[model samples]
Target chain A: MESKNDELLEISNLETLDNYLSNMDNSKSNSYISKIPEVCKEYPCCLGIDEAGRGPVLGPMVYGISFCPVNEGSLLVELNCEDSKVLNEKKRDDIFVDICKHSNKIGWAVEVISPNKICNSMLGRSKYSLNQVSMDSAIGLIKAAINGGVKIEHIFVDTVGPADKYQAYLKNLFPKYKITVENKADSKYPIVSAASICAKVVRDHALQTWKCKEGHEYTFKEFGSGYPADPVTKKFLADNVDVVFGFPQLVRFSWSTASNILKDEAYHVEWEDIENEAPSPISNSTITSFFKMTNQKSEKPLNTFFSDRYLSRKVDL
Target chain B: MAIHIQSGKNDIQTNPKFSNNIHSMPFKIHADCDAQISKYFLQTPIEKEILSASFRGHPLLGKEIQIPAGYRGVVLHETMKPATEKEDRKFYVIHTFDKFKYWNWEKAPSKNDPLVQAMDWIDIAEALHSPVVEE
Candidate 1:
């Protein structure tokens, strides 16, 4: 049965969904949000940040922010914005609509980090670790809110990594705002709960409507919530994977699940040393060893022609 | 001596000091080249060495990388002959396949270039217009 949330998302249109994916360059990132709420200048606004879909192997990871006057925590509670994981999709969608209706009182935003973007960022040569990437996204959202003329005072965050470290990092970044980073701050703080709802809802919409190009065969029934642990999703991954080209664009190639799946099914060949000529002590093989040739014969310094810079010979996998 | 020899065939494989690092072609590239390279690698055959892989300038690797034939071109140092004297050339030494292979090129091999028969890097030669290694 199609849930009201899916119906509201209008995800059934494959062209619309594929167009959204096509808007961003492959391996590039983008975001989506409801209109930013106009903050009451007289009241000190409190902002809460939370992320959803961090664990899922498919779909984009979403970061959400919810903000309102510090005194208006009751507004969120009255709207039934509690721990989103416990809330039904209909209930969350209802709460999201209410939040939208009361835009002046409540402001929210969501950043959808595509699987391709995640793969690109994580696997790129510079190697911005996932944690760092998450932090950057959170920080960017906060900065955007403040820059957009929101008077943010106290910040609450739900963290997956070390809370203390995350808090310290945020504090360092925004010295003017009081920051609290804790595991499951979503349950403790109404604003965070609202953010969690926003995140979850957006993620659902994204996943439900996910599409690649026109010709590729795709059906929503095959992919579940995109969690690695889900059998349905795993089955989808296992079934849909093209050994040569890999799973469709939705799958994060950098994820061990996807890569591991490919390795298991595909006929991968790696180059290995057929014969070990020098039984040099394994400990002695450093990058410098290439330069420190024991049997020095020619005076040529091996400068531009070639440099023996690869240290792969040290450890045989 | 302008030409120096640094041989890593034995040391890289056996040295316990570098045991923690799993050295292979670090599959990272610039955003611009990523889609093209990935498309080629994923859709194409593995043994079909022509245009197997490509990369931007890397510290441990080469600058403006193209794989297999280009790798062989760098180490062997004679795989590519420039079509014109005005063409600029660059080179790099990278670790791969149990040893450091040299890679350098002035231009990618043309589709009908006689060298394409012997080397596959020519397939991607047009795609990669920049240096694989930086100074």
Candidate 2:
């Protein structure tokens, strides 16, 4: 009953975001993708894995894998599982179950890299760590599959991060399998399209779940699809970020978002307070402390969605 | 002679992962390896060429590639929605970015980020061409 009420509120309250975007115009650039031939030699059982939302402002990076026997993958091909971007969400949602049904195997591994941790990396070479998380999850998924005894001769992944990084990651991770990580592997391969569907659906659910549990009270607010240049999302940040301790547990402080939130100020002041520079990982107790903070502040008791053991690390010395 | 080392058009699959254990550089698999498989795998070479070239010369390549914005463009059959020429064909074969790069009518993204290190890549393999259907 509560879930039903929350969904209704989200739909009704965020009604201003009614503008429809053509999925085609919004598709990943072609330069990021390519095609591969059906290596029938790797048949009997072949697996393809990919990820989505690695660059988004909100939500966990979701990794998905789709598998089918090369001999009996007629169901997958018949569904026209070309690419997830080519199909509407309704169509994707509808066929998702069917694809997994025909899949020789399917799996989703999601890791929510928090905004604070992301904040540290943002100061470094890149702003997003979802790519790193994606690489990790992809490696974990393949390792899981190999352990599960499914024979995958060829592995396809939509490319992520620097091309060089992808190459290094794959070589070091799966030296035995012919893992091809190109952009638009979805457009070029049905297997990847299937992987995209699994990733997309799962991540969308993760976002909606976070939204439902948090409600409209505070700790986090509207990110307006979590894309940069979203006016409403930007406004939400300006409206809420004045508190001294800083942004919500979910807000990625490493994004231009944190700096932009402090745009009114010179930014150096904000940095001094939030600069969490330490070679050591934040103990899980810090995560718990954050949860307690939110729960204490909110009108309702907050549920901890992630780990709690992030404290007791002797204060980052 | 080295068994007259059979080359080109070999229908076979040898592990590229462990090439040192198998064939040497420019190695030959059974006549039906990637060469033959690649050709048939591609439904239309013209379309694949267009996509390959566009990807190689990406429009979003900020300062890395200096392409002029006014350059002409073309599209591939798959990238476009309709098989016929009437639909929205946004696939531009050649285009420039920030009024700089001329997209040399040829080259692939792989070439720009050349594989000099020869490390493993995240290679996603899709069947390049759809299976031929009789009209």
Candidate 3:
């Protein structure tokens, strides 16, 4: 019932983004790519990469890539694409909608890295830093674009850490293309601005439509901006501290803001080591008897056999 | 107050319920939290028998344990609360299980675990109580 352009217009709409996100498990990272622009497939195109929500303690971080014909760089400026941080949410949404209208010239993709995935990668036994996660997302997006048949020749990226190191790393990975990693590429380059808008719009919509996997019904307004500095976010973190689970999956548990709150408020959970530690000089019996003296009224002394296995008898279900 | 376990008349015999894919987290949560377990708590087979899953952010290793022959596990549900102090609270046997996976935080579930050691006691108790034959 709808024309191709009309369908493409829905790409920036709230309902469509919500539908796409709701269908997938938000606990894991997900990727979405636009249909390759017909012109982009035939002509040599310049691609740009940027991200949004990187520092947020809540919601997903989005890595976005936008590509257009090499000569159409000015067209992005004409569409009012600019640094997403400077533009308000409404202005970014408008520019994204305008970009969608010219779908024949530009194509874009976004990788939505969920909060749970971020926390898992950072806090897991083998620590994976946030910078590594960002780099992987950027690399993944570029690969997705190239694989989708966008004949990209030049690539621009908004840097995560040291720009020179990131530029060298990307250059090493993608030897064929001209890659530029700059501090404020979103402000300097129109293509990077377009990418920033795409990423920002997707991230904003993700926060708006977020359904807590842990089944806590919370409005987005309740936790403002997802920044550790925001008072609302701090209050939300403080108010929702669970004795055992700490916080819901909506939070990035690896964030010092959330972890600090848990350290102060939540119950202490001790994880035993896989490899046995050397026994204490005081002896196990001495410690057991000491605990028995203090816990005489509340608990029965566990047998030596059961204690060796770290078993405690349950009095109730 | 006393508690009474009620065995209801629903006699549908199903396979032993095993939490094969669930992560047995170390800590317990008191709040009534619900989740789409199948969607979120996915387990990957790390080796031939060892399984791995993520809980919160921590990695969990797990393995299935079968109850010794002739032993069964039951899952009970509380059905009613007593109206008066004189009456007892009631719980019903909702289902039964024979084998369930046990998980350890970042450690493999093995014979050294408390649950596994507890199960070992069943065999020991049986051997100890059995009649001895004099040669």
How big an interface RMSD has model 3? 4.8
The per-model lDDT (C-alpha) reads 0.63, 0.45, 0.81
Best by DockQ: 3
Question: lDDT per residue, candidate 3, B11-117, as tens digits?
Answer: 63536333343334655544434444654555768897898766656667888777688877666777566779777677787666667778776678887777778
Q: TM-score for the first chain of model 2?
A: 0.61
Error of 1 at B68 (Å): 20
Worst 10 residues of 2 chain A by lDDT: A16-25
Give the candidate number with the greatest lDDT. Answer: 3
DockQ versus reference, model 2? 0.01
Per-residue lDDT for B17-98 in model 2, tens only? 3221121111112222222222111111234332311110011111123122332122112333556644443432221122
CAPRI-style quality class for the chain A–B interface of candidate 1: incorrect
Count clashing pairs, candidate 1: 21
Candidate 2 lDDT, tens digit per residue, A1-317? 22323223221111211111011111111101111223322455566777766666544455777666656556578877768777887777666656534323333222333333344344432343546655766777767666655667778888886666686678777787776777778888787887787667655544544532222343223555455566766766676553332344345555666556654532222112233366667556655576453534444422321112121222223
lDDT of 2: 0.45
lDDT of 3 at B34: 49
Taking all chains together, each candidate's TM-score versus the true structure is 0.60, 0.45, 0.72
Tens-digit lDDT string for candidate 1 (A126-181) = 56677887988899889878876778889999995999998998999899999989
- Which residue pairs collide, candidate 3? none
Residue B80 lDDT in candidate 3:
60
TM-score of chain B of 3: 0.76
